[model samples]
Every structure is written in C-alpha cells, then in structure tokens.
Target: MERVVITGMGAVTPIGNDVKTYMDALKAGKCGVAPITHFDTAEFKVKVAAEIKDFDPTQYMDKREAKRMDSFCHYAVAAAAQALEQAGLREPGSFDPWRTGIIFGSGCGGLPIVETEVVRLHEKGPSRVSPLYIPEMIANMAAAHISMQFGIRGESVCPITACATSTHALGEAMRMIRHGYQDIVVAGGTEAAICTIGMAGFQNMKALYTGDDPQAASIPFDKRRSGFVMGEGAGALILESLSHAKARGAHIICEIAGYGATSDAYHITSPDPEGEGACRAMQLAIADAGLTPADVDYINAHGTSTPINEKYETIAIKKAFGDALKSVKVSSTKSMTGHMLGAAGAAEAIACAMAICDGIIPPTINFVEPDEDCDLDVCPNHAVQADVKVAISNSLGFGGHNATVLLKRYE
Candidate 1:
C-alpha cells in the first residue's frame, strides 16, 4: 500500500479560527464556551455553547458567494481554503485537477437554514422559501463546494456519521490515497448546529449541559460533569501520497499510519457499556499501523463530558491498551472547544498530528474533581511538554459509530 501523509491543516473552532490561533489557544488552555449568542436561549434549559465569535464570511469568500452558502458551508470553505493555502497547492496549474479530490463530513448539515425556511413556509407559504434551500441544506454541499472552489475533479464524498463523521472522512481519504484512487485529497468535517431548533432538540434529549458558568461547563473526565456543551466549527486537512508530496516538495506534517471504524449496533444514541466496538476500533487501528499498544505515546480522547461517554471510553481504552494503558497520555480538547459534534474528531485529529510535530500534548481543561473510572493521565488542566512520536485520535458518535485515526511523527 502507498503511504499517506498530511501536508496541511486548517480549523475554524470555538477557541480560534485558524490553525495557529487554535494551537495557541490549546497550549494556553483557553476555553471558548460562553452564553449562546446565536439565538434566544431564555426558554431553553441549555443556555451556553462554544460559538465562533465575530466570524466574517466575507473574509473568505465574496459577499454574493457568502450570502448563498449556509453558515456551515462558510466554515467548511474557509477551513478548506486555509488548508490549501498552507499546502501551497491552491493554484490550478500546480497539480492535475483530476488527481485531486475531497471528502468532507457534517452531522446536521444546515439546521439553522432549514429552521428558518420551514418557518417561512409556515408563515408566508411555500413560495417564500428560497430556491437554494435544498442545495444549501444538504450535507454533501460542503464537499461539493470545496471541489468546485479548487477545481478538484476526482472522487468527492461526504460522510455523515454523527460525531464521528469527520474522522471517518479522514480515514477514508487516507485509504483513497493508499489505494491509488487519488494523489491528493482535501478532507475534514464542518458543523453549525447551535441554532434555535438545534439547541431545543439536544436540550429535549438532555444531551447539553445547563450549567451557568461557561468556563466550567465542559469539564471532561470529571466527577461533576453532567453533560456536553455544544460547539460549532469546521476542521480540514490536506492529505497526499508520500511520492506525490515529495515530488512537489510539500512540507509533510506527519504520516497517517492507520485508520479504523466500527459500529456498536447497540444503541441509537448511547454507547455500549462495555465499549466493545470502541475497543475493537482502537485495536484494529494499532494493528493496521503495524504497531502494538506500547508504541502509542498519546491519545486524543473523545471525552464529551457526558456521563456514559466518559465512563465507557475509559473502559475501551483499558481494553484496547491492556497493560500499556498506563503509559499513554490522554486528553480531551473538547474540554476547551466544547463538543463540536461532527467536526469534533477532525479538529482533534489535527491537534494530534500537531502534537506529533511539536511534541506538546494539549490538555483537558476544567478538570477539577477526578473520577475512579477515568483514571488515566488525562493531562488535566494544563498542557504538557512531551515527546509525542505516535498518537491516536478517537471519535465516537451517536448511533453507535466509532472511529480512530493514527498519526506518526515524520522522520
């Protein structure tokens, strides 16, 4: 199989808009949670979220183009453009257009737009709804827009796997390169689900944290954690085959060693108590990398701060690593960025790849009280300096989806 490597990364997260700002915020333990400003949350139980503040879409696209896209697509395009810029491959003449592709993912495509359009239909009748409603609301448009923007004519796909959506996209992109389907792929996930209907849906399910304090609301792996704090953003990466990247003299950030995906088939929203599916996913990823558990130095946990999620994820880690569990340093960036839903795994995967390159493991902030179940070293409350040669990022989603991606420091 051909080796795949990551050349560039871009992120539009709650804590920061670009990769540098995001990494800086992570190293500084800056939390992005605040009172929900996108809508009126007075009637809703959940009052807070991690929103991208003061976002100006015009900075990334023309005013007309910006107006046509949903906010989620705006995020996706901005992040994708940033990634392409960092890769220094945005020019049409730089690479064969047919050899480049894209794989983007989103959980709830354009809920905010759908909510408003549905209201327009109810109050002002069907004719009032915009003609672009379906095009803007579809989950695949994120990838479609990226393909159009960059003139990539190869395989373009959008995978929707709830929270694990982006990780699955990244893993599939890696396989696409390894399998000789394409030489370069722009891959990642995006989300914008912090609107009125979106919040009410999660609130009704009791999935969101109703805590008053923004800084302390997203406390992962802590005894007092009640629920996850919702967040919205996009994360993107430029992945290319090793031969292709070197031929173009791309600055390789890291090597994508392996990927694994599984389904629990146990619950629609809740994870399996034993974490059997998650364990299998991790084991498979490790084996695919031709490595044992001991070779992994760090793990970016899918710690959503939900009670069941944290507990079972710990069980999965123990089962997957066994005796090597104690040696791995784990942390949840969601503690700072809140739960980014579909984009969570993709954003954290970038953080893990950056860790391999920079030798710094981002911390799980807001961790106060410890729990016996989550007993691993979670790099709690502070970023740590370490030699992170090999790292794995875990993303578990609703509907029993589990995915893991492994990255190794480029030598």
Candidate 2:
C-alpha cells in the first residue's frame, strides 16, 4: 500500500474564507460565532451562529452557475477550486481524469432550499415550486458538482453519516489513494444549514445553544457549556499518494497516517456514556498508524459542547489514551467556529493539518469554568505553540457513528 499525504487545503469557514486566513484566525483564537444574519430571528430561540459573512460565490464559479446551485453547492465548489489551485491543479485537465476522484459530502444538502420550496409549496401550492428544486436539494450534489467541475471520473462517493459525514469523506478518500484505487482525490465536506427550519429543528430537540452570547454559546468541556452553536461553512483538502505528490512536485502539508471508523449501535442521538465505540475508534486509528498513544502530540476533539458529548468524549479519551492522556493536549475549535455539522469534521481535520504543519494548537476558547467530568488539558482560551509531530482528530456523530484520523508531520 502507498502512503497518503495532504497536498493542499481550502476552506470557506465562518472565521475565514481561505485556508491561510482561517489558520491565522485560528491561531489568534478569534471567535466567529455571532448573531444569525441569514434570516430574521424574532420568533426563534436560537440567536447566534458562525455564519460565513459576505461570501461571493462568483469568485469561484460563473454567475449563472452560482445562481443555479444551492448555497451548500456554492461553498463546495469554491472550496474545491481553491484546494485544486493550491495543489497546482489550476485547470480541469491538470490531473488524469480517470485517476482523480472526489468524495465531498454534506450532512443535509440544500437544507435552505428545501425549507424555501416547502414554504412555497405550502403557501402557493405545488404548482408554484421551482423546477430547480430537486436538482438543488440532493445531498450528493456536492460530490457530483465537484466531480464535474474538476474532471474527476474515478469515484464520487458521498456519505451522509450525520456529523461524521466529512470525516468519512477524508478517510475514505485516503483509503482510495493508499490502496491504489485513485491517484488523487478532492475530499471534504460542506454545510449551509443555518436557515429557519434547520435551526428550529435542532433547537426543538434542545441540541443547540439558545443563548445569545457568542463567546459563551459553544464552550466545549466547560461547566457552563449549554450546547453546540449552529454554524455554516465548507472545508476541502487535496489528498494523494506520497509517490504521486512527490512525482508531481506537490508541496506536501502532512501525512495521513491512519483512519478508523466504527458505529456505537447504542443510540440514535447520543453517544454511549462509557464511550465504547469512540474508544475503539481512537485505538484503532493509533494502532493503524503503527504508533502507541504516547507518540501523539495533540488531539482536536469532536467537543460539540453538549453535556453528554463532552462528558463521554472525555471518558473515551481516558479509555483510549490511559496514562498518555496526562500529556496529550486537546482542544475543540467548535468553541470558535460553532458546530459546522457536516462541515465540522473536515474543518477540524484541516485544523489538525495546520497544527501538525505549524506547531500551533488552536484553543478551546471561553473555557473559564472546568467541568470535573472533562479534566483533560484543553489548552484553554489561548493558542499553544509546540512542536507537534503527530496529531489525531475525532469526530463522533449522531446515530453512533465515530471516526478518527491520525496525521503525522511530513519529514
């Protein structure tokens, strides 16, 4: 099997639209969570979100094409274009069409469009619905659009494992390259689910932080944490076999050492309190990487700020790392970016890549109070600069899905 490595990354995130700016904002511990500006919120209990501000999709695609696609697709195409450009694939034919692939995904694609057309159908009857509704509403469009946009003809799998969606994309893409199925892959996830109905659904389930304070809304591992803050964005990464990247003279960012995925089969909406599946996921990833837990330098946790998630994730870490837990520094970027849902895993995976490359760990901001249940060294409120040789990221999704990927600093 060939080794896989990240060649380039791009992001349309709540904090910044590009990877460089996003890394800068993360290192500064900037909070992107703010008031929800996508729609009026008078009748809603949820207030703040990490919304992408002033995004112009025309910057990446044609005006007509941008208008035809949903917001999720817009973000997906923009991020993929940026990643391709950064990886020196600036044109459609830059890579072998049959040897290239894309695995981008969304948790709930075109959710805003779905909400809009449903509203129109209810108020103006079915005849008033836009003919573009079905094309814009499917979750697989992110992958399909990316595949068409970049001439990727090998594979286009789009997974929909709730929050684990994007992490699965990266992991599966890595497998494709590592096992010689594809030479290169554009992999990640995107989401634009901050619309009225999306927020209302999560809020009705008591899964979102209804509090108005942006700083306090998504405080993962903190005693005062309420729940996850709803956010919208996309993240993309270019992955290729180490040999392919080297032969193409690509600038490698980091190595994707291992990937592990498992299902809890325990709950529909919550993780097991003991973190059984989550523990094995991390252990499997570490073992697959041919390393012990002590070799890991940092962990970018799922850390969604929900009480049960934080508490049980802490347990999972303890179970996976044991005494190594005392030395491993962990943080949740969700404290700043809120929960990007499907986009969260790829975004955080990019954070892990940045940490491995730059040796700076982003903080878990607004961590003033510590919960005894979550006693890990969370790198609270400030960035920590250290020589991070290996980093691992965990993404635990609803319906018992858990995924972990390990990254090593490219030598």
Best by lDDT: 1
Off by over 4 Å in 1: none
Candidate 2 per-residue lDDT over residues 198-287, each given as its tens digit: 999999999999889888898999998888998888999999999999998999999998888999999899999989999999998899
**Residue 220 miss distance in model 1 (angstroms):** 0.8
Note the Cα lDDT for every prediction shown: 0.93, 0.92
Q: How many clashing residue pairs appear in each of the predictions shown?
A: 0, 0
Candidate 2, which segments miss by more than 4 Å at Cα?
A: none
Ten contiguous residues minimizing lDDT sum, candidate 2: 88-97
Score every model by TM-score.
Answer: 0.99, 0.99
